[model samples]
Target: DQQVKQNSPSLSVQEGRISILNCDYTNSMFDYFLWYKKYPAEGPTFLISISSIKDKNEDGRFTVFLNKSAKHLSLHIVPSQPGDSAVYFCAASVIFSSGSARQLTFGSGTQLTVLP
Candidate 1:
């Protein structure tokens, strides 16, 4: 069973518009949620993140909202630009122990296309 799921395989948006991506997770132990953006032939880079204690987090044009009770999360991009076109992935991690590395579980991914 997948702990994290991105139901949408892709999304499209016009430049300077908003793009929304959704995610769902099955694990309650997840304390941290993250979004990553990846381009072809490159590694996924960190985008935004939210802690379980907070309902939302924002960084410039990107924002992430978490609803623990519903086990759902969404990422919003405001004024989406052409450069923002890429594969977006939702990831969740639980802290197993102090001083231990976090193991992240990632959703498949959602490809975002920004049309000019």
Candidate 2:
């Protein structure tokens, strides 16, 4: 079974509108959650992130909300622009032991299209 899941395959929004993407996880040990944006023929670029200890984190037009009790997280984009079109991925990671490397587990990803 997949630890992380993004139920929506795609999303579309007009320019200057809001776009919302949802994700769910089955792993309770995951403490770090992140959102990444990927373009064709390019690597995923980190967008926003939130720790399990915090309910919400925001940066400019992007925001990430995490609900530990529900094992869910959501990414919100305000004033969505055409350039924001890309595949959005939800990832979660946990440190297994002290000074251990973090291994990120990614969701399938949701394609977001922003119309001008």
Cα-based TM-score, every candidate? 0.95, 0.95
Q: Please provide, for model 1 over 1-116, each residue's C-alpha lDDT reduced to its tens digit, 9 standing for 90 to 100.
A: 99999999999999999999999999999999999999999999999999999999999999999998999999999999999999999999987567488989999999999999
> Which ten residues in a row are the worst by lDDT in model 2?
94-103
lDDT of 2 by residue, 1-116 (tens): 99999999999999999999999999998989999999999999999999899999999999998988899999999989999999999999987567578889999999999999
Model 1 CA deviation exceeding 4 Å by range: 96-99
Index of the highest-lDDT prediction: 1
The ten-residue window of minimal lDDT in model 1 covers: 94-103
Clash numbers, per candidate: 0, 0
